[model samples]
Target chain A: MHINMKIATKYIVVAILLVGFTSCQKNSRPNYQYMPNMYEPIGYEAYQESDAFANGVEAQLPAEGSIPRGNFMPYEIEDTNEGYELAKASLTNPLDSTQVDFVRGKELYDVYCGICHGNKGNGQGKLVQREKILGVPSYDDAGRAITTGSIYHVIYYGKNTMGSYANQLNEEERWQVTAYVEKLKAELEK
Target chain B: MKHVIYRNLTSRILSLGFIILLTVSTSLSAQEGDVAKGKSLFNANCAACHKLNKPMTGPALANVEQRLIEEEGLDREWINNWIRNSSALIKSGDAYANKIYNEWNQVAMNAFPQLSDQDITDILAYTAAPPPAPVVVDAGADAVVQEPGISNDLILGALAVLFALLALALVLVKRTLNRFAEAKGIDTVIEEKRTPIWKAFIQNQFLVLVTAIFFLLASGYFVYGYFMQVGIDQGYEPVQPIHYSHRIHAGDNAIDCKYCHSSARVSKHSGIPSLNICMNCHKAIGEVAAETQQEGLKEYGVDYNAEIQKLYEAVGWDGTGYTGETQPVKWIRIHNLPDFAYFNHSQHVSVAGLECQTCHGPVEEMEIMYQHSPLTMGWCINCHRETNVKVKDNGYYTKIHEQLSKKYGVEQLTAAQMGGLECGKCHY
Candidate 1:
């Protein structure tokens, strides 16, 4: 009777252990979500391809030359040498000194330009240090006597070897970055 | 003494070479404007369309003087004339100039009427100058040999040995006890003479009932727990189109999360990076190192070069000009909140100033990215209840902050107190 009891207890313990072990740990399978239809609503997801849209397009941009409300005046300078010269000669930031937040500007600049233009603006960014890119000039370098307009122009239509950050950063953010870069340039000059 | 003489000779040779180089550079500077002046002129006038060593819209100007004078038999004066009026030269049917125009697709060179002969010569000097060597290059991530400490396997082996030794000791003690009992003339089988435990247990009805009830309750609790965890996908790591390692980029290289996912601060969704953004870095960093190949990548059986090749193919970059043929990488979306739920990355990441890891878990450590959080409503509500609203320094939260602090009667307020738990806030 004792032998029988011992065997039965061992079996029960093993069974309980197996069940417990199976239930534990992170699982790849998802738990049941009720009303799965509510989970996947029939709405326009940006990149999700569906035949619901015309030309089988996913995301659509607004038509060209239409400005949204509460936006700053659009840049009129063409992406040409003439335009660069024009901007360098005349274009100025509309945001006054009070509106220009150096803290936010620094944050934006670090994100967008610091990868290539160094956090300190010494032209020794990580990519440059790693030999991934060469010949990024310092702000204090004699070759590039860039003005605020020139910086704005560069951000809008990128200079040589540099891609435009227009898609990544908006106009306000771009102006902020320009302000921060100007600050760095002043520091380097000092 | 001979070794010392040889070392001295070598040092002399090196110094002589350096002196000759310095003189030549100085003479060239004298011939043109100084090299620095040439560099400035080149950058101001020519950098838009030209490179020193690489062909962009215009041919590289490396050894342009030598090539033009020696190879093409063109006049030294023609370069000045060409820079000043390339279209005029091409139109005038100057054989060499037209040959040049035809060689490259008939793209008109920009007229730099402002540049003097000295500026042109300096630009040429700057272009011919060899590129400066990299001053600093730290050995990238793979060189450090981390000393691995006592692994789980070693601990497990030691534990198994200890357990066996303990079992043996216990058996030996039992045998000794039995022997002692036998020597005392007390039968060791006295244990067997007692009623069997199961029989005794069965005979006590009240004890059996209580024991049965406790077991049923425990089993029921476990069964419910197992069922409750049915659809919550905690670790659903799907394969992405590219084997992009967040550990390598975000962790090893320490690239900021927002560098690639730039739209996260502004938009509803944390945007997938466009191919152009990838090109910004990948245009130069084309392949992974052999050391990385042998490390984590080897364990996963991934070929790094092939994955890079896939990126090149998608982006239509053949190492030179973009072919303009492109295809979007079909990355499998992992995190899918149900339609009823509303989650804005800007609201959490930008407004609240939460770290990416708060919801994404330790993404920098994940080789294959996964959904780390349960991402259920309970998870969201729990976070809202616990998290304090970040109200300082934001212009958007000015009026809201004053009212919230007054209502709650606290300086610092949790998200729940700020109406984060309102059903319409997330649901509608």
Candidate 2:
């Protein structure tokens, strides 16, 4: 019986030791790298931190008067009431009828705008339905009849509660979404 | 007969009086507006810009009529006109209207020309309604819930104590037996000792060889496992600066992955969303819902609202607008490939049209994000070897795909057949 007790005590000690060793492998920290130098980049990576810049971040805004490469057109409309009105009245879509791809437009719209402005553009979005956001006007709202130009302007400059989606969607993509919004608005009106 | 006629006439007059009283009371209530109807109206119309307690795009509208009457000396007529058409009111050179328009950065309020006087009354009633009481965490309920866990340990302890008592009793009984035997002058039996089990086992050459071989194999297996997982961080879960719950955003809200990771559709990297993107929704949502806050505290041991406050501080939003002071969040990158690897997010996410969850592994369900896949070269190659190339709707590559399939003599072409296995494709 004494020998059996000794064996049992030894087994318990072994079990405790195993638990301790396994518990030491915490998931909160990263695993040990064989060679960190090879894994880490020497050049400045996206969102890297560095002391070279004034802000100490690798990402920087474009210099003043710098133009992006590729087919780009600068928007002259200022972010003001007058600017909004002007854009709403005059800023027609540059893309001709043939260039409008409804499928791609729908895809982009669903990702960005459909969260707040319902996919059907009736203002009953997920956030609104969940009571997180409210008072999103429907596309077919007659009081503020949204034209294609106004849609693009609103997307670019972001009216009232909405934030500017210019960073997320490019000028061409913005036009695409504008076209889709018009389509949704027409459907809502029907 | 005359007395009966007088009694009937008196009863009829009382019934007429009661009908008049009911009509008056109902009319008074209609003018006051139903609180339930007002709440729905407020949420649907005024809620986007005007919150009851907080300043949003518009100012807080709690008891707005009384506050306006006292502070701005504006009446119900002025509010009615403003609600119908604020820009018109401003154009008409109304002093308070112009002041408010300028104060709110001239963001024109949408004209609710369709709203009747009754609708306005209902909305005003909603704004005037008293705020709901704060939810109190019930300590008694918490204690009740905790009882079962404590009882489990208590039960274990009780069993242990019972076994110890049994052991002690047996020991005492044995001592008594020995003492009795001694008192009676009787001998206790003793067994002659032989070679111990270990010594006897060591003497058996075949058994010793087999045990040694078994130990060697076991050790080798363990060593191989340890070495194999040296650089593969499959289950790496690091603590972030702010506790962002993807479960709440993606799973509960059902927001698409591409909503925040917008660049993944066009760019090489699935970039972390900027603070502006967070502000898109969080500007209105300063704090989480009460139930969500409770859930975070009870389940995850986190105050979700405090994390939102951290985000606001980082973004430098002083409740209403940007303060022009921003700090970039230092997010720890997970699932990073080595410097030599060349992975383009747009290629797989957009062109190939693969769901983000295919690689991310149900990111919506994760409370704290972790590396779900091993992300090893073998893992990547194995997927490439099995997954068929998405060739449908690719008119540009239809001829090439057909030719390739014909060359391979297969009905469907795997990504490997489309040069996905080329070392230069990923390495260079």
Candidate 3:
């Protein structure tokens, strides 16, 4: 009787464990990591609070006028109408025609500008076409005919109804986008 | 009485004819440039501030010429001057201009010094025309968009139901057979002392051997699987600080994934986007949409508006400039590789041109982000083995392709054939 009881208990335990294993669903909780230190490194995450730091600041701003290595040349134009006028009058692309990669520029443009400005640069993008945003103009329009400097200026310090893309794109990338926009504008005019 | 009725009908008809004639003459005279030309011009200059049917940063410009003339006592010349330079008008202390400026939150209308009188007239003409009816793109898009969320629960439920029915049928059959045996006066029940399970198991060597082997194999397999699960986080979905729906941003709105994950093309990590990136659109779209709010967040079980409030708190944006009291959004990281394993996002994303969804598992459909792939070494090696090196257009691969194709004696070479499995390729 005792042996039978022991066998019965063992089977019951086994059955319960098997049920528990199957019943526990995927995405219920995070499964155990063997060595968490390996999975989650000892390195500090960007913008994460650390015990070593006071006031919980990790990503500190660089000194004013400092530039990262291999980045674009520093843009001097400030975010102002006078600055835009100055850029338009004087600033030409440092990159020549050969330096421009319209393909890369198109890729960047699609990511950033094609939502509001149509893929064809015809001002009928998904946002404008849906009437979510009004008044995006075609590049071919006489009043909206833009130069490289004007495009760069607007990208650097956003114009009316558009926000600054400076944070999202580096200086070189902004130029790439400008080159692409010029291509689109030329195409529309043609 | 009949003669009086006829006279009344005739007078009414004459009045209607006169009104129609007046409308026809005004429309004829009011026509300016080609309406199409006017529309293009309007989109360029006037669209930034004005909507024809609704008010935006500037007043609704429907019947704008009439309104400005009749209501505000401003003529075409005054309107033309205002278009050229509203700032000058406001500075000159024009009461109407100042009032307009003050009403519009003092956002100065940009000067159109380049605009000719004809250009302004064309824009005015476009505005005078009736607003176009909004076009609704097909309902078929939404209907076709939803991929069936297939899971194993359906199969499991069916199996459970089948087993229950089978058990019921078996029990009933057994009882019926026993009663029939008794009715036939056949001795079916032995009524002997039952053998202990262990003893019975021991007696049946074949059964014991099979069960032992199965147990041994199953346990061995289970133990191996458990050990393999060490660094493999297949479904490690942690609750994020805020509920940011990829479905809404990436799926429904068709926002490019790279817009948020900008660094994936250039950097090592598929970097988390900064809060400023979120602000690009969120500044305009402050609240959770009414329809989206109705559908509760299934994964986090959090309210939609409450999530927006959390974002507001993180960015310290009170619908205007920064409030200075800010907290960074600390999203729980889902995919993490070991420190020794080096995975360059640019190498796979930019150079190799693998879609983010290839590794990320249809992120557009994901409401809450989770680790869809196992992120296992085996998974990586398998992909490298199967995937072909795209060598057609890329200049960098041309020389390598010639040599590798010669070496392998094949027309097309896979990633593995090009030394993708070399230890230094990943480990270093």
Candidate 4:
């Protein structure tokens, strides 16, 4: 009986230890890799931390006045009130009727602008409806009769509480979205 | 009796009229503007740049009329002029207007020539109204959350005590029965000893061999499973610096994944969103609603406002403007492909028009992000073998697709038939 008790206690301890080992596999840390060197890149990966730059980051802003290669067109308007007024009056969509694709425009608009601007541009967006954001004006608002030029300017420079969306949408894509916004405005007016 | 009834009716009518007169007088004394109308107008026009009690892009505007009259010695006429055209007011060299313009970063307030005098009065009345009281969490909810934990422990304790008592009672009963047997002088019969069950089983050679073989096979199977999962980081969930709840943003708010990860549609990688993308909405949303905050605290154990403060710190936003001292948020990347394998986001996202959720799994339901797919080569090959290439409106693949369809003798060609299974497509 004494020998049986000893063996039973030993088995119980082993059972507890086994349970502990399996339960200790944590999800908060990464699993062990067989060969980490092959998995990790040697060259600088996007958003990697490095001492190579002054800022100690892999991502770097382009040098001032240096343009990107291929289809590069500079935005000349300064981010100021006068610049906004000038753009509002003068800026026009470069894409002609054949080039303007409303379907593509709507897709881009839904991804980028529809969260706050609403799917129909009537100011009652999901965010606005949830009261997370407010004071988003409708496209047909009389106080600010947004024109094609004005809409493009606001998107590029981001007037008031809005942020510039130039980085998200390319120049041609912006024109496409501008054309879509005009369509929404016409519908809202009707 | 008739005289008494008549008197009572006349008194009651007089009191009802008096109550009506009091209500009318009180409403007249209060601003002639409708409060409800003012609130709707304020939310529509002013809430973008201003909060009534907090300093947003503009200064807090609570009790502005009274404060302006007392402090600035300005009246309604000056305010109306400023509201209509602040730039014009500043151009006219009004001291207060110029002071405010410089104070708020020279950002010209949009001219609202559309608002008439009555509208302005209504808005001002709304502003003058007292701020709503802070929301108190329901005491019943707190009790409900706490009761289960207490009761569960209490029940367990009672069960344990009862079990111990029963065990003691059995031991006592057995000891008394043995005592009674001893007093009665009854001898308990002893049985002859035999080989133990384990000893008998060991003596059987065939049974021993079978048992040994079973143990070897079981251990081998376990070892294979352990070795196979060595490099694959399936269900890997690392803690991030900021606890951004995908459930709240993607699920509750229904924001598109592309809204933040804009580069996914055109680039090799689905880029981590910059702080500016977060600031776009967070500039206006300084704090979460009370219910949302409470929910976060109870369910997620997170202070959402504190997390927003962390975002502000990283982005260098000092409530009103950029402070120009920013720190990059070190987000731990989750889904990483090995350097040897070639993968492009735009090829799959823009070309195939695959939903982000296809590979990411039900991300909207995930509170903490994790690796959804095994992302092994076999898994990729399996998908390619099953998924037909989307050929419609794809000019680049139309001719090749037709050729491949004829070669395979199938109307729809799978990605594998389109040379997707070639090693050089990914490895080289």
Candidate 5:
């Protein structure tokens, strides 16, 4: 009976110990690190500490390590006039593979540029035909060898009679229209 | 025999004690109230006028319990009375009640006579409860927290160690009891028991077939789970360089979620609020108590305490303070579904008029923004199946509802009926 009591007491003690351990762990909550102001360090560290930080900071700031993709096509005014001349000469076929893109390009061109540049690319645009504007060149006119860059530039930063179309077309849409224009030039040459 | 009996009894008791401890601990941890249901109630009723911490049209509710005890002479009775009918209490010449009534420009606190004592108790409990920990958004510390997908491996290792320790402890205890029995000259039965059916089968001719079948079944399940979870990032908390808190801005301050996530009602993405948006608030609100008081001022001009000043730095605003040199806030993207997923915030937010909390969890409550939704195709489909589309008087959905009702029965056509559950709805 004494041995059984001793065993019972031992078991009770073990149970007590387990309860004690678990109870002690009850109040131990996981420490969660709360960062209330993360943007603060990013701003100062990005500007003051980094080599790329130039003083004139403004809204719509470009992301760090972001470079403009695609070819570097300068939109210089003098080059634009010469570029359009060249596009009228050598650049004929659309560079992109997709036919749907070309079709979309044609639709967009009719909406935006058809009034000034004409439906047939024969320089007899609506404005010129109406005698409201002149000096629109035909696509087959020799002497100018327009690269894709000049045509894109002229379309983006408007030349002569044309206004700036940067607002109307996104980068991809601009590229698509550029492809279609080349197709029109090729068709005209044929 | 005596020693053997004693050893057996001790081991049994110890094991039973351990099990009890585990159960008690598990139960204690699992004493969580339904936060989701609590949130819905809070937003529907309290969110329009009161905030958790900051002063809105009314007083901040961070320590309303303490205020009631210290300031107001009444406790539960007073709160219930005020919620039930504040005007009636004010008429009875309660000084504190009259003062609050006048302070709120005589705008009567809406009488929620329907709210039971239990419901009010839960709300008060939530208000009195300490706020959850803030989300750490320091870009520098992010690298340390997420050392390129190491958490999974760490968890696996810890589990392995835990199991090994348990096995070792069991073996040591068994050996010790055996030694004690031997010392007392107890003749222990050394004969092996009959092999269990499962153990016998493992050594039988069926081994090859069972192993193959088991492996094939396991692999099939694993692959299915993997494919199902392809784009889902349920708790994806990316390591952002900045520790921005949505809880502070949205929950505590009661700032509208749309004020920061302006694109949600208009664009494809709920675009991360730019540095300019941060400037709208943070330009003036610069200091937090813990960061400023504890950390001391770091070398960076970006004040840790002054959240707004950080916005200024991001947008290049000199505090004199407006030389339009703005720097954009480079927020690390957290919830990125693949490009193919066609999630439009306007469709759900503006058209359906769903709250941001429906998909993003309680964003205002989240200290660090995490991908709260599982974002899985299955999860999306499940929600679409379960959730009844809000199709009342919305011009966009009204026409569709009529057409859908003509085809299907008028049992409140769900978003799924309007092609919301189609793979094309979410995934292109």
Candidate 6:
């Protein structure tokens, strides 16, 4: 009887364990309902390609290889009066702003021009006033009416005592300083 | 027969109790969702369009549940519906839906119909939960505010308590049954006394040798791990001199992250903006709030306060003003990796196209910047191992993909395969 009781107890324990494990495994997943029609209907018909007629007359299409107008230009500089004029007119502003360009011009002037042309742009520059350098012209001199082109050219390929600034000042930078020098000339003349 | 009946009853009852305990514990564990998985999902899906505390394409998702509940009359069902198909709801003349659509400039929200409801729920829960209050970065303050939400430590504590109570009950039942058996003059088979671990070890020569070997192996492994992790500061938070809030700048005002860290895409260093850059806006911006005193300037409206005056002092800009003496703003550096670690911000921000917050954490929510990533070699390698290289429609990767496919015979190449996990890539 005791042996039978022991076997019965063991069976009961095992059954309980099996029940527990199975019950725990019984789809504990939270029920989720997926509704396909909840969102907007997507249209695929708009993407299809359609040709209307299969008649004998073919469409006259442009040749596959044709060069369009105004698409080509040589990337070289020519040294002539006409070329220089075109270059001068074509030369774009290197700095975006007048303020920035002016600031840059002032900085450049201080570095290069201030020794020859005074800070105040008067004839009495440090070199001229100190008598270290001579033949410096006052911007208000009677004979000269400097054009923008002349000023640009003088800055590009310097005249008389001045050397060529082609290497020192880039094309656009020379023009900017020329603008500033013109401002100084006007200030001195005023 | 009586004795048999008694034994069977006792066993059944014991088993039932064990089963009940196990069921309860399992159910409790199921209630808490995985936060790490939620974080990854959030980064992948939501981070591009939305920030936690800042406005992007959508409104800031910080405390999103509360906002939805109060503002939109939304429950969990409504949120799930909106995430799946917002345009459909808008078309159906939902008043709130139309308002949100118009507010966001009619930009179509991406449909996430594939995401399970449980996943959406977990994401919402993460959004609602306030981040752990920042650690008192200063060594002077030892008070660290634990992160808000169901902490693992708390869960473990509760489980421990429950198990302890169950153990006590079991002991009590055993004692009562022993007493009953004794009273009935039953022949109880006494259980053999358990051998003490030390005693057992001393008795068995083989066991002693095995134990020694195990100890040596464990210690060696632990030492190796410790050495590997020495300089890695995964969660390093350093105190800043000033409480400059990225939340205010990047979040509230919607300032572009690149505006301040401009060199992020263009240069090796995500260069700290010079004081001149700050002055560009700050010169006109002045004090954000009237609460702070206006520094530097003497006239109440015209003069700058002491703090702004410091900026003037740095750049040598006298407030008289524009005396042309400008000084640089000396901002303290926050995110510093080792010299050997070659992390190019441009490569990550521009080329790979990672969000700043991936490594920086939720910078928009931070009052002061701190190093969020441990920036360890392992952390980097692990990320490279897991993250797939973004190759779709990128011209740079077009040639690379062809080569990779030929070598691996796979359509996709992971970041690790693309030399991201190379020691030289991160180091040197």
TM-score of each: 0.68, 0.89, 0.72, 0.89, 0.38, 0.34
True-structure RMSD, every candidate: 9.0, 5.6, 7.1, 5.2, 31.2, 35.8
Candidate 3 local lDDT, B1-428, one digit each (tens) = 47766778878899999999989988876886456778877776677667677565577788889898899999998888888877888888988999988887666677777788888788888877777753332343334433333335667788999999999999999999999999999999678788888998999999989999999999999999788786577877777889888977888778888888988988887888888778666554555544455455333456888887788789897764458888877777788777778899989998999999999998898888888999888999999999998888999999999998998899899999999899998886
Tens digits of per-residue lDDT for model 2 on A1-190? 9999999999999999999878757788777778899889999899999998999999888998888999899988998888888888999999999999999999999989998898998888898899888888888877678888789999998877788899999999999999999999989888
Q: How do these models rank on TM-score, best leading?
A: 4, 2, 3, 1, 5, 6
The candidate 4 chain B region of ten consecutive residues with least summed lDDT is: B132-141
Residue B261 in candidate 3 has what lDDT? Answer: 91
The DockQ assigned to candidate 4 is 0.74
lDDT of 4 by residue, A1-190 (tens): 9999999999999999999877657777677778899988989999999999999999999999998889878889888878877888888888899999999999998888889989999988899999899888888877677888888988887878888898888888898999999999999999
Alpha-carbon shift of residue A179 in model 2 (angstroms)? 0.8
Evaluation by TM-score, superior candidate among 1 and 4: 4
Interface RMSD of candidate 3? 3.5
Q: Candidate 6 has what TM-score? A: 0.34
- Candidate 1 chain B, which ten residues in sequence have the lowest lDDT sum? B141-150
**Residues B1-428, model 1: lDDT tens digits:** 36665777878999999999999998766466467888766664665456667676578787788788889888768988898878789888899899988886665665667677777877777766767764322244223322122455678889999999999999999999999998999966744477889999999999999999999999999999777766577888767889988987788766789988988998899988888888776665566655666564436778877888899999998865689887878877778888888999998888999999999999998888998998888999999999998888888878988998998788888899989899999888
Model 2 Cα RMSD, Å?
A: 5.6
Native contacts retained, all candidates in order: 0.37, 0.72, 0.47, 0.80, 0.00, 0.00
Which digits, one per residue and each the tens of the lDDT, describe model 1 over residues A24-86?
A: 553543446667887877878867877866746576567898897897688889887668778
The DockQ values of the predictions, listed in order, are 0.29, 0.67, 0.44, 0.74, 0.01, 0.01
Query: What TM-score results for chain B when candidate 1 is compared with the true chain B?
Result: 0.60
Candidate 1: residue B413 lDDT (0-100):
85
The alpha-carbon deviation from the true structure for residue A31 of candidate 3, after best TM-score superposition, in angstroms, is 3.4
Error of 3 at A161 (Å): 3.4
Candidate 5: misplaced stretches above 4 Å?
A1-190, B1-203, B207-212, B290-309, B323-326, B396-400, B421-428
lDDT of 6: 0.61
Extract clashing residue pairs from model 1.
A30-B231, A31-B230, A31-B231, A31-B232, A32-B230, A32-B231
Tell me which residue pairs clash in candidate 4: none
lDDT tens digits, residues B1-428, model 2?
Answer: 47766778877899999999999987676459677888887887788788999898999999998799999899989999999988999999999999999998888898888788888888887787788877665564467657997999999999999999999999999999999999998887767889999999999999999999999999999999888888888888989999999999999988899989999999999999999989889888998887788779888999999999999999999999999998889999887888988999999999889999999899999999999999999999999999988888988669979899889988788889898999999997
Question: If both were scored by lDDT, which would come out higher, candidate 1 or candidate 4?
Answer: 4
Q: Indicate whether candidate 5 or candidate 6 has the larger TM-score.
A: 5
